[model samples]
Target: MNTLEQRYQFISLLGQGGMGKVYLAEDTKLSRKKWAIKEIPLTGMQRKQVISEVEILTKLNHQHLPRIVDYYTDEQQQHIYVVMDYIEGTTLQEVLKQKGVMDWKDTLHYSLQICDVFIYLHHDLAEPIIYRDLKPSNIMITKQNEVKLIDFGIARSYNQEKQDDTIKLGTIGFAAPEQFLDGQSDHRTDLYTLGSLIYFAISGKRYDQHATTPLHHVAKVPQELSSIVQKLTKHDAGERYQSAAEVKHALYKLLNKHDNNKKEQSITPMNIGTVMISVIATHKGMGSTHTAMMVAHHLNKKGYKVALIEANKSNEFKYIEEDYDGKQHKEVQTSCFSMHGVTYYKCEPTIEIATVIRLQYDFIILDIGCDLNQAWMGEFRRSQLRLVVGSAATWKKQKILDFVQQYEKEETKDWVYCIPFAESDQMLEIKSELRSKRMYAVPSNPYPMKLQEKTIAVFDEVLDHLPLNQKKKRLSIWWLLVPTSLVLAGIYVMMIVRM
Candidate 1:
């Protein structure tokens, strides 16, 4: 008997079924690479069917699909083996058995990954391939938290003109009703199985074939997700999503809405460390609002909780806000709003507002306009970062130069950062000239500020150097009492307004 010992070192038996025994093996030539080899006793007739399936597997190139490496028969020709990429993780069925049920977020994430794999199989392929056996046992959750589809033993190409599959295929619980009725198994068949699979993963309960309300008994499932799963599992293929792409889009929408709602609900006051940034204009006609807006927009896009406040006496960002939809926050008096996932406030940097905002946001950028008086300068001096922004034009450069020279002599000069706004072509020259000073220059960015890695790196360098407050303020009983009372008063006011 010739075993696989010549080319591959067998590690252990992975699993066995009626079809074959799978072994964890490592290639002798590529010792570091591991593979799963399925050994099946095949007669002469069985070889032809397996060859056709192997051709399809050999051509598959997807991140989530297992890659077939090689196939060989021993000297006796009684058994043949199929070698494939070893997915190092438990099956979804095993995960559910051990963990009971998964959180909706986790279930949704896994489901979306599975949907992406199906999208490739059904749409991206030359001929749409139907994964007839769609079940948790066939889906591997890798150690790296990636979902890998395995066991394409019964997968077949879908011919749109055909009326039905040649054979009935799929697991009993997860299979669509059409699969048993001699009806065609298409994209919708996979969607049906996916819905049942998701329901099982989330609820920790087996999907009941007779149950009309699959997700109804699972209370923790979000209403939005419930609606999607219900539609996907509809017995009638016409009622379900037409393609895997459609299911993915629907799930993505729910995820986005869930994230936005999570952000909205987290307005409670806490002792979170926050950095207050002051973007002060060194000269008139300098783009202070522009600088503040751009910086805040970038930070927010970088996953930081940022709020841009118009603290200048003149409403410099007025035009910008008016152009916005102006429906973020309904409190007309506060003029506080959210746009482009960043919050903006049209209010002076008063002590009370500043203190409250410091608790709510990671970064609060104050657009203090062009007026640098004693009171304004005093407030700017206290900030963790105070930037003097101005134009780089010859006339404007004089004011910036004078301001930098005078600023160097100040006690809080280390906190001062200079940013000269120049045309896109002059950024390199401006940066080189101001290299000696702790200064930054702006490159021309597209309007509305789309997120860019390079732009984020620049902002990251600026933020990383800004010193964090290390001294925790010891609070007296009165210190806590005041905020507690304020919270109660605010709650009362909200209740009264509702009445």
Candidate 2:
């Protein structure tokens, strides 16, 4: 077999069934799109069955159904390759097993929808079809709670003129009686299996839910549908529903009755905010660390509880300098949080990102060196942001700008915000350059502790771009404390308030 892992970028193996294995793989030929690749080992009649199912599913264009996108045999190896839409969501079997059944209304609602799916598949197809296998695992629910019937591997088109065109294949306990005896099946065979399916659904377990109950004390099937249930399980092939449509209509009617007693399915949307990831990239001598630290520090002081992640390994100790000429400590009333100048470096930039993100910080700004395609840099680009910071040199700015533009053309959401450094007499020219590049310009001045008016305004602009859902409150500003009479007096006032 052609190991798909050798060629295409492959995600994890999703499932391994009796027929084959399904993998979530990336199709580079399809513009690096995602596809669910199924590798089936064909034997005797199985190859024919796989080919026919692929042909049928390709023609199927239902929104709820998964469509087959590509099909080709790997002649070098000897297996058939089938690629289809990789639908998201857990299986119905998983939901039932995990949630431990459900309320009568929920169960009825699920069964009712499954019936509708059968109706759509049978009546809507060019030629009516019969899904020989109807089991919980085969039916999947989307993230939106929309029902989807999957695994068309065993489905076959119905024959009107021919009488005995049945096949001997289906799940054992869930199969109709005639299917076990012989291939004496038709659309009615599907209906019988569906009835068994509903029986399992209503009972809130497998068909054998009440298997251990005493035979004399077993719950009785209703008089109206007792014969219908018996016909489904009848040893004789002659005794069953005429078609899948009949069974579907019956289940839908029950569904309406169930809905009349209570409300139907309700799906609520989750709250998604504007959380983005950005990497700060620059040359080795460009002072990218200082720029990144200043940006994070400015945003944090302006009424936002921001998180500063140290993405570089070299400057972890230098940035957190223990001695800073008594300037790191300053006074500001609006800065309600720890106003000791900076949160400093905490994120130890390692190859292992899973360990890095555990220390939660709001804005994860990665300070990157000139190295573009390193392992961790690639991982950072895959993040929500990839920022390139350049210095006063035009070539440096141009190189970084070209990188951002190329990335932006490929992905619109990825953005590159530029910041130029100017500590000399060329401050006015630096501002002009920033405006030309359509970027935010910063004045080379004393750090934020001086609480300058211009620096504070710039902080507000960064705050606007920050995550808006942050909850704000007065912060405990005692991270660094020197005992004094003032502290005692403050405690006294707090004690009186408690009283």
Candidate 3:
């Protein structure tokens, strides 16, 4: 049919599967906006199933999910049609076919996006929705590098009272053990399929639960990420990650660790440029402002132009001006002061990051206070590097967990955690609990102006390729040569005196 509902006009056939055909359609009533029209032949029970799918799609409102605009049944033709947003992209299956295998970073990015959709379905709704099927063909990647999940034919809402699903659904290799074993598939089932999807994305091969080979052994995947995949694909649902949030957090930790390694390896004397670093505290009294100031001064002393910005509502910079400088400056949109060769910008309601970026400083440091509701989060996300100043105390550790979990949807690859006054063992414990290696124990600095050796060492490790550290290494070599030369001169003078 050329037109349905007297509005959607069929343009071309997009694709066809066992269920039905999808067509590219244009809305005649509107400005010819494109949409995907799926037509499935009505059967004994399929008409009700199609209605169920429509209900699920209508309730969804996520960037990665398609919007169901219209749906109707063609009684004369015995077919049901669904009109939805036309996702213009290639499926993961097509990408895998062209490239054979995807890079781990690219796979991780897509996986994280899929997890966001899962979280919306499983936890954000009144009734939990279990996406019974997840495979490469169901995932689409746009030209702008965005992910979209398609094909909800097998999706179903979960019921806690039910002991088992009415029907067994899902692809063979990608399906969880419970899906095939007559057990009720739940949120963990989707996670199991996600692990298989990741394995297939990185290895260009299906994950065989029976095979002794592991994911890392088959592909050039990181052991930590591969281990997460293994945990996700465990035979028992209880053994797998219980929720998509947990899986997302584990993936975030892996991505952060990998990115830290790459950054440390890539840093060199020639490539040093304007780097933005954001410092945020998990709670009040976490010393985030002090940590930011110390970092600014340290970088400035290393012969780099540094700008320290107060992007939060703490007004610590204003307090410093009144107490230390003996003058209180009125707060405006932005105010500036200088201390220890570091330029400080007191920003009210947060200053434009672009404006500060245009000044072209070697390093721009933002101090984001404990309030997560502030507008400075945009700047924190835009910054090239992030430092989370949190407590290492066991009781206060929950704050750090909460902070990270809150932003689990964002990219955490460049994030580094700094715990003030934390012992080495404490840092180790937190790192292990979070499954992250991008953590540092910051020593207390009473005088922010003075750069202590311990503080310098911590910064040196966190921010690799410091000019000061390089100069010290050169000086150390000369230090060894100078002492040897003086000893030789003394021995020569003694021999001359004897002669």
Clashes of 2: 1
Distance from true position, residue 57, model 3, in Å? 1.6
Q: How close is candidate 2 to the true structure, as a TM-score?
A: 0.48
RMSD of each: 18.5, 18.8, 19.0
- Which tens-of-lDDT digit does each residue in 361-444 have in candidate 1? 678888887777777677678777877776667656667667666766675345444454466445455445555445565555
What C-alpha lDDT do the candidate models reach, one value each?
0.71, 0.55, 0.80
Candidate 2 residues 3-104, lDDT tens each?
453444577798888778888887654456566887777677666766876777666654356666557777644577787767778887888787764444
Candidates 1 and 2 compared: the better one by TM-score is 1
Stronger candidate by lDDT (1 vs 2):
1
Which candidate tops TM-score?
3
TM-score of each: 0.54, 0.48, 0.55
**Residue pairs in clash, model 1:** none
Q: For candidate 3, write residues 98-209 as lDDT tens digits.
A: 9998999889888978888899899978888999789988898865466788888778889999989877878988989888787799999999899989988888765564
- Rank by lDDT (best first): 3, 1, 2
List where candidate 2 sits over 4 angstroms from the true fold. Answer: 1-8, 44-46, 161-167, 208-240, 258-499
lDDT of 3: 0.80
Q: Hey, what RMSD does candidate 2 come out at? A: 18.8
